[model samples]
Structure formats: C-alpha cells, structure tokens
Target: MLRLIAFAALGALVGGVIVIAVGPSTVGYTVAGIALPVFIIATVLTLIARSVGNAVGASPEAVQQAKDARRLGVARIDALRQTGTQINDQPLCELDLTVQPLQGSAFASTMRTIVPLTAIPMFQPGTERDVAILLDGGPEVAFIDEGELSPAERARLRVPGRGSVPFIPVEPHQRIVDGRRRGPLLGVGRAGRPGRIALFTVVAVAAAAIVVVPYHRAVGQSFAAMQDGRLRPDLRRPEALADAQRALEEAIGHDRVASITVAADFIIVEAPRSAGDTKTDRWTYRDGAVTHDGAATTQPESTAEQFSWTDVALDRVWTLMQDGAEQVDRPVGDALAYVVRATDDDVHSPAFGRPAGPPEIMFSVGDDYGTTSFVADADGSGLTAR
Candidate 1:
C-alpha cells in the first residue's frame, strides 16, 4: 500500500517531469507537485461501486464514527465517574486512529492516500481532541488542547448561524461545539470532477518528471533527455571520436536495451532498468595512462569490460522497505535493483579482480520486495553506467 501511494504520488511526479519536459505549459501551473488524472481513484470508484459502502462513506463515516465513539465512550466515562451503571469500566479495545486503508495504487503515497481522509473532519488543527473518540452517550471528557481554553480569541469565535456553542455535552450529538469555525470548513468544499481530474493529471506528470527521472538519470543528461530529447552524455565516451558510429547506435536502443559500462577494457550488458547506478570499477586507457578511476564504485550498470567489476555489487542486495514518504498498507513487489561486478581483471593478482557480472533486477510494490522479478538480455553495448 505504501508502495502504491509512493508510486501514485511519485508516478505523478515522474509523469510530471515527462510532461513538463514536453511543454512548459504543462508544468507552469500545477497544484503542489501533483495533477489529477482523468478517472477517479480505484478505491473511490470501488467505494462508489458498493451502495452500502458509499452510503457509509458519503454520510461521513469518519465524522459520524468519531461522533458516535466519542458519545458512547464519554457516556461510559461519565457513568464511571458517577458510580452508576453496572457495566463496570471494562477495557474495550484502544481506539486505534491509524487506519490501514485498503490497498491503493502505484501512485498512492502516504500523503496522497490520506488526502482522501482530509475530507472527513473533526481531525484537524487548533482544537481539543481525544487520542481516540468514542461514541454512545453522555458528557464527553476529552483532553482539550490548550488553545481551546486559551482566552486569546474565545470571545470572537462562535458557532456558525446558531451563535455560541457552549462547551458542554448536554446534547451528546452536538458535543463538539463548533467554537471558532476558523474560516469556512475545507471538508465541505466540493471539488468538481473536472478540477479533480486536472489535479490528478498535474500530479502524475510531476512525479514522472521530477522524482523518477532525476533519480533514474545522471546529473544533466536525465533532465536534458526528457526536456530536450538529448541523451545523457556518456561521460566515459569522452570525445566519442574513437567509437563514433558504434557509440551512436549504442546510445539509441529504439527498443529497450539493457547495457552498462565500466571504464574497463569493455562493457558488460544486462536487461534491467538500472544500468546507471550499479557499483563498478574502471581500468582503461584515459588521458594517457591506464589508471584506475577507483577500486570500488556503486552504480546500476557498467560499460567497461575485461577488467571491470560491475557485477561486484551483484552479491550485494536491494529490497523495498518502508519509506515514511509513502503511504502503504502492505509491501510492494516491483522494485528494480542493479548488481555489478566492479571490474574485470584476468591477472592472478588480487587487483586483477573478477569480471563484472550482469546487473541483478528486483521489482517492488510499495514496501514489499522479492516478489516478481526477471532477467534482462544484455549485449555488452552502449553508455557506461553512471
């Protein structure tokens, strides 16, 4: 679920970068880093699909639930205080406010998933609230935030229409005195279908463009590619004169090409999305000497060969875990991981190291990992892994 939210939110951002690169008009005017999609979310659609679920929801289940629970719980509390009801204060389950929502989509992030709940109120700023509300009957005793009693503006704030709502529970249903509406209620603000769709579209594109693309590509090239159709400069290629023709072909795959470059003798290949960050080592003729760029490096792919250890990282592993940024219920199963051999060395010396192996791949869904995975076909061609 977290993965879904991450993806959904990030997908929009990734999609955003793509569209933003396409046209300035696309990203110039966006709300937050998101844009609404054309269709309603599957959860919303599904909720709407079931008549009972929709009723339980549109009727403000969150609001009503909060209300009812507060009522009953308060009633029990009052009874306990007065020494009356025989229903001794039995320990009911602790009302857990953290609701694990149903599975969301690839784009749903923790913030995005919870964005829906934003509509249900009594859950907001500047008010006394129970850690968990109980509904039933009686004067509810809630731990009020200091602000509720603060004399700051208690005199000015009033209940809408009916004037003042005394901070009393005479009418359990109206226990929550609408003291200081604090401006019009945002939950009541309705977003038309068109506005919703537009918002989704904007967010989707933003995710694709900003979050995914930047992380996926090198410093300049990734941005240049999407925005200007310019391929990231394989810095390892240097002048491009030594292998101009092959370099051009190696650069453009038309179809997907799984390849990585180590600064070794030649490049190793693979069929994974991460041909960019696999840990790698390079040993080649550069500047004027066959110096080693570094004994160890972390990247998803390698473009050099023979003395390349791109596959060194293949032994290291990657997994999809919790990202507080994402809102998910379960694990995701489609995260991609890159494995490298570091360098390819034929010499018996320890420095001669093992030849880099093809990159390993992992897929993820939100916080889950190790589910569906596939190997890519590599041909030892194209740009060196950054």
Candidate 2:
C-alpha cells in the first residue's frame, strides 16, 4: 500500500513538473485539473483496498504456520456448519472432526476453516480423509490432504519419525489468529511503532514535497513574469490599453494605423506604409514589447475607411459593456477582446443585426462558458449587444 501511494505521488510529481514547465497557461491548468483529481481518486482507492484486505485476510504469521504444517494425520468429519462468512467467494465452515493418529485413540474437535469450492463435496459428514496438522503449534488450524496416497506415503506416516506427534491436541484458549489489529491509516504491525512512525513521517514529507514544491516554483515564476510584464496585460483597464496603443504607434513610427485588436494578453496593430497603399504592415505587441509581423494584403476599399486611434473611446466602450458582459469561472481576467476596424455590414447577428456605419469597435467578452459581443459606433456611441 505504501508502495502504491508512493508511485501515485511520483506520478503526481511528474505531472506537476510538466505543468510548471508549461507555465500558467490554459493547457497547464487543464492538465493539472484533470490529473490532480485522478491521482487523488487512485490514491484513495488503493488505501481502501489495502484496508479491506488487512481487515478480512489472514496474517503473515498464520499463513506461514499453515505452510509449515506437514505432519500427516487422519480425520473423520462428524458434523459441518457454515459460519456465515466467506473469503474469496469460498464459504468458511466450522467442522467437528474425530482425529485418528497412527498410534493413539481418536479425539473429537471443532475447527473453523474456509472450505474450497472444489473440496465442498468431499468434506461431508462421516467422511474420513487425510489431514496435515502442525505438530508443534496448536491444533486450531488444519489443512485437507488432497493428494492421492501411495504406498510410500503410508510407509512414511505409519513409521515413527523425528518431530512426529500422535495428534495435535486442541487448546482451550486457542482460536484462529486472522491477524493483528492494525491502525486505520498505516496498518503497521504490533511491534516497531517508533520505526513505523519515522517511516510514515518521511513518506508524508516526501509526498507533501512532491505536491508543493512544483506549485510554489510555478507561482514564483508567474509572479516574476507578471512583474516583468511578460504575462497577460489587464486589458480591462483603460490605462493598459492606452499604453498598448502608444507602444503600437511607437513601433510603427506613424499615426496612419489601420486597425487595432486588444486581446486578453496582447494587442495587434495594422498600419499602411503610405496613405493609399493596398498592403499594410502588421505588428504584435506583447510582454511589453512590439514586433513587426510583416505586411498583409488589404482590400483598397477597406483601407479608404481607416480611422485614427483617437476617434474611438475604448474606455467608454469597456465601461458600458463591462457590467453587462457574461462572466466566467476561470482566472482569465475579463476574458474579453476589443477590435476596432472599419464597419462591415456583413458582420451581422440575429441579436443586433448588421453593423452599417463609420469605423466601429466590437467587444467580445466571456470565457469557456460562452461569449457575448457588443458592437458600438465610432466615438463609443450606439452600443448594441449581440
């Protein structure tokens, strides 16, 4: 059981390391969410099975004694009754048997034993059968001899030998020693309590380290990234958006920006090289840095409707839609996107119809549950939810 728990903890540690290496992204959270529950369930089932086995199964000492019992004896079943117990689908029965040794008179005794399915018919009352008993131990336990008796076996049993007893006498205080009672959590044996405690302490600390170390490392790295602006920017804030716009303008070195897209973490900007150019240069601003993403082919007609960044008030649009936007349970802040571009009448929805006007801003907000979009006219007017 300890080994099983250790393996499970190792698997969890590996998963945690993978999550940390992947960083605090959607994939990391998804893997952690699935793996943590699975690990917990596996560990719980393992402990439950161990507890059940220890409760119902024989102890190590009793099993060893049974294996060591080899003296031959004869027994006739006087009566048989079920104890209303079972082990591995086999019925445990109490048997009254008259034991007949090679040299002594027969004696009647009662013993509780698990009757194998295949041997049930052979163990009926008045049936005489070969038995093996422990000569040195108490006669509380005995095993049915299922092997065919040949002349050699009779010779060995009939002749007196070393460590041979006429019959194992039943002791009044003797009862079946199933096992020593174990603690609910550890299942340690009677002796060695201090050793078990030390071992358990070590295992507990190791298991805790397996779960905590990687988590703390991941959190620390995430905090460092946030401090360095290498993580998601809070686009729901007005100042963050303004700073992104300024960064975009500085990267492009011109005010002739075509469009801007503000996402949860980063911003995308498009700007034409010249006043009437059909191709526009694209830039991606993220982690407090901007990079040119080369040129993209733009429709000449779309380029004619370009608007200045100052024409749209993103703060007003965010404020108007923030309260009405759908919320999600994830840690993804706001879970929203803002796209400012020329109005396209083709962008239609059943809830808000088509957008037909000057340049417009489309706000997409929500998370995994669902998304709600709001279309607003340039200058943050005529906000329509879709």
Candidate 3:
C-alpha cells in the first residue's frame, strides 16, 4: 500500500510537469485514449503469469520424496530364496536378484531384489527392505539392518501383494505419494524491494498523468475568468475579502485602508471569503483609480471635516479596478500613484455637507507623475487638484 501511494505521488509529479510544459488540453486526451488500456493489459498479463508459474512449480514435499527413493540402501523384495541358503557370515531366507541395467546405477532397475535371513522379518512380496544396501556390489548383496521400527511406521507396510514396491522408507524433506517418491517444488517468483519500488514509480507516474491534466485545465479556466472580470463577486465570500484586505495592508504598509479609492478605470484586487489567503491570487480582486495623461480636476463647492472610513470603500476600489481597466493603454513609467487619506484641513468636496459623521471627501491621490496632490469626491467626479 505504501508503495502504491508513493507511486501515485510520483505519477502526479510527472503529470504536473507535463501539464506545465504541454498544456492540460492535450494531456487528458492522451492518457484517456492511450495510457489507460495499456495499464489494464499489463496488469492482467502479470497476474496470469504468476498463476501459471505457481501451478507448474513442484511442492516441497514431492521433491524430498524423490531424493529419499534414490538413496543407496533401501531394497525391494523381488523373490524369496530357498529356506536354507547360506551366505558368508549370515543365513539368507531370500535371494535378491537384479535385472542388468542399460545405464550404470539407475534407480529404475536397482531395487529389484533382496536377500534376508529367516530370522529377519520379511515383507509380503513387494514391500521394500528398510535396511541400507551396499552401494558397492558384494557377494550376497551386503545389507546393513537397523534394529527395530516404530509400530506406526511398521503398520504402513501391511498392504498385501502389490506388484510395485508400495512403500519406500523416506527421509526428512521427502514427499510421500502413496509411498512413492515424486519431486521437490520449484521456486515461485516474488518482487524484490527494488523491483516493487520501480513498479510503484511507474504506476504513480501513469496515474499522475491521468489526474493532473484535468486539474491543470481547471486552473487555467479559473485564471482566464479572473482576468476577464466575469467571475462571481460573492464566489469567495467574507473570508476571501478579509484575506485580501490583510494582504493588501501588509503589502502597502503604513497606508490606511480608507485612503484607497477605486478609479473608474483601475485595477481591482480582492480575495474570496470561503478560501481566504489560500486562493488569494485566484479569487481576490483589486481595482485602482484611473488616471489619464491630462485628466481634468474637480473643484470643491464647500469645505468639510476628515473622517475614517470602513474597508467597504477599499473593497469597492478593488472591484472597480478589476472591472474598469480594459482598453486603457497608459504608458508604463516609474511614477507611483497612491491613495492617501485626507488630513482634517484637506477634506474639501461639494458632497461634504454638514452630516451625522465627520463629513469629508473620503480620499486623496498622490503620484510621482507630478508634485501637485489632489482629492477625489465620493461620486468620483474627478480629481480635485491641490
């Protein structure tokens, strides 16, 4: 699972880079049209290979049984000897004979006969002798006998008259199949750590390509909407607005919020309420007051007192800047235009009649374009040249 996650992340990274380079439009079609089917095919093939390999591999027990059957000693009963036969130092009840082998020492023909003394327990015709037979041929077939057998092991030898030797004494790790030897199983394949890592990396890259393209396209659409001013005003909400205010405040350190006023044709900057600072660049709006080369100034009709204004006015300025600055191609210059709040003595505007709050023209404008300062009326009549 960890490998899967890592692979996904790697895939996403690769996909994202591709999105940046090629544009999201092409990536989505390419992955959907080409990558998906290939991934499915590869996965199916891998599973099939694993299943077939397991089916053909030998079981551990089978392999061990084969080894046990090939041991130098165990012999099968071919035929019984005359009751009074004598061999070098022992009495033999049966004489074991062999078929001449086409190949040297093949187990296929070697266990044909056994000679044992009358005192020894003889198996019914086909049971193999448990004693170790000499590897080197000898007169009377020298066999070494171990003392006794466990009752459980001896009980297994009681099957009557089967032509083939049904039971062969087995060693540890040998497989018994109806008391016959078979095979040791083959190894199954497993992905090593490095191989697994590589696999995940490939998968992640593939997945990332599939996912990132669509996200890239969505972001592009959002950016285009933002640039066009067609986005919903309340889309982000109060939090977006607040975050935008904070960021603007920080950027324009020491500048009062009330001092900023949106120009009729200006840049608007703001944040959406729900997302706040996270999508500040995407959802925020900012509007600047429009200025022309020789714009006319407004003359005040009366005098008024200065007063602090709410952030509402600043919000309007941002909205207006986003909406208003469309075809206005003013020359770029070193001049900086700034909205500066009016001092008590400088608040002059016709709209500032005696009112409930300290009535004043809300804001003033200053720019490096000229030394002359000006004030803007609440209605945006024009800049009042100072």
Candidate 4:
C-alpha cells in the first residue's frame, strides 16, 4: 500500500512539472481531474484485495510447512498476553505453555501467534490442546493442532503424572506457527488473480494519461499559434526600439521613459506613471502593441538627465553590436538602453577630463552565451568589453 501511494505521488509530481512548463490549459486540468480519482480508486482496491486475502487461507509456504510437521503432543496453556498488534483484524498474542511430548518430559516455552476474535475464548490459561513441532525443529517451534478431540480423549491426556523439564527460551525474531490460514500476498487466493491484473492495468493507464495528455495538448496549442503567426515576434530589428518607445509613450501619455530592454522576441519599456510622478510604470511591446506588464512602483528622484528617443541613434548601436558579435564569435542576444549620471571615472572622462557631465545614454549589449558584455555610448562612440 505504501509503495502504491509513493508511485501515485511520483506521478503527480511529473504531472505538476508538465503544467508548469506548458502553462495551465484545459487539457492539463482535465488530466489532473481524471488522474486523481484513478489513483484513489487503485489504492482502495489494492487495500480491499489484501484484506480479503487475509480472511481466506494461509500462504502457500505455510501450507507446505504444515504437511511436513509432526505431532508433538498436548500443550497446556499457562499464560496469554496481547502484544497490542493486529493484522487483518486478528490480534497478535504471546503465549506461555508447557509442551508434553509423547516421549519426552513436559518443557516450558513461549510462542507468538495471531488469534482471531472468535478463537480468543478457547485460548485462556489452563486450557489443554493438541500441539505439534516440525521435524528437526525445537520445542519452541511448536504449533497448535487444528484437529478436534473428543471429551474422553481430552480427559485421558490430562492425567497428572508427567515429569517437568527446564524452560527453553525462543529467540524474539523467530516466528511461531498458527493454525489459522491466510491467502497469498498478491490477491485473495486464486480467485483474485484477475483482480490483481486489473488493478495493475488501471495504474498503468493513469500513468499514461498523466504524461501523454499534457504533452500532446502543449504541442497542439504551440503548433496552432505558430500557424496563426502569433507565436513569433519580429523584435530583433533596430526599428523595434523606436516603435516600442512610441507605443509606450502613447499608452502612458508621457515621455518620461526610464529604461528599455530589447530582446530577440520582445521589448520591455519602463516609464513614469505620469508626468513629474516618482512612480514607474512598465509595459511589454510584442506583436506591434504595448501591454501593461507589471504594477507601478515608486522610484527615487535622480539628478541624471534623460535623452530623447530621436537622439538614440539605434543604427549606430546596432553597428557596434554587430562588431561586438564578430569579436566575441557569438550572436547578440539582448540590449538595454538607459541614462546614467557622469561620474569621476566615467568612460567620457578619458576624452573630456571632467569630474561630471550631463547624463548620457548607456548601451549595454550581451552575446547569446551571456558570458560577455559590451558597453557603448548613446551615440555609439565607444565600445568597451567587460
């Protein structure tokens, strides 16, 4: 049962990964809805089958052992204690007994067995019953005989003349044989063999649905989007920057552009929420339109100056990116355009020899490998690799 639950949990984890990677969709929800009930039903059926098996008969191995056992004699029950353990509604009991073999003297020993509710009354202390031990086995390996005896025969065995022998202790790990029988581990005897196969089939089908359903759904959706020209974006061109800036300005009704990030498939633009507002708004421009990408957040006021989009000279920046790709031997991946205040160690300081200057546009470009970065001026004046 624990193994079955573990298997079901693993299937759920794999299904969760599929949903995360493909994004939530109708097919993903349907697969989860179906797989959950299937797993529960399979677990319940396995438990029921195991219970029925326990009530039926002993395992095949126990039956073979009984065939080879030899009768020892009557055993007088001295004490019986419950172990607080149960299997299939039967309590496990530790019994103290004196085994009087037909040939040898009576010896005291301990045995552990599972007693059914119906048989508890018959196992009380001072009761005498037939017992047996396996051939080449010790007295501690005794088993209760299943056969019934007449009242006269029971009276003859109770005659008080048997000599006493020393007590022999059995190891805790040893198993004591019980007369009751139980069915096989896999099913309820031979009749449940088909049920076991059916349970396995259910589990297999559940696992397949968990894996294949989400996979085909994601593939079909992606293919459909591609055919409709909705999955691909033409944002790699230099003009995409101007178009994104214009769209963001139009949507926000302001020119307070803070930053713009250009990538192969999309462009993100950040600007102030309104004219002279400290809070910032963000938008993603894809498929030639701008959409609100995130919530507005307050930003600290800065002394740095901002540049006009017309003065960006994106063509010069693209040329520098092409040159960078040649030097790095990798294609350009993304670019970020922002204004930065001139510092004492600014790149312009080498040429102008000034401690500070007006804010200038900073262009940062990276290769597809993401291991290298190149910085350039707004007018594409200088290229420095970092």
- List where candidate 4 sits over 4 angstroms from the true fold: 1-233, 294-298, 303-305, 334-370
User: Could you say which candidate leads in TM-score?
Assistant: 2
Clash number for each model:
104, 0, 44, 5
Q: How well does model 3 score by local distance difference test? A: 0.36
- CA lDDT of every candidate: 0.30, 0.56, 0.36, 0.55
Predicted model with the maximum lDDT? 2
Report lDDT (Cα) of residue 122, candidate 1. Answer: 37
Q: How accurate is candidate 1 locally (lDDT)?
A: 0.30
Quote the lDDT for 284 in model 3. 15
| TM-score of every candidate | 0.22, 0.35, 0.25, 0.34
lDDT of 2 by residue, 52-84 (tens): 331223344654554454444566776888766
What is the per-residue lDDT of model 4 for residues 253-293, given as tens digits with 9 covering 90 to 100?
A: 86655555566545676666766665666777654446796
lDDT of 1 by residue, 1-386 (tens): 22234345545544554444432323423522443432235444433222121111112343445444332111111110111211123211111122111111011000001112222233332222222122222122232233322353333323221112122222211223332112212111244546545655565565556643432323333344345454332222333213322332243322122333333123333322223433434332221112234434333333342222332222222212222113344443333333333343557544355434343333233333323332321322221211
- What is the C-alpha RMSD, rounded to one decimal, of candidate 2? 13.4
| Poorest stretch of ten by lDDT in candidate 1 | 104-113
Name the TM-score of candidate 1: 0.22
Clashes by residue pair, model 2: none
Error of 4 at 230 (Å): 13
Q: For model 1, what is the error of residue 117's alpha carbon versus the real structure, in angstroms, after optimal superposition?
A: 30
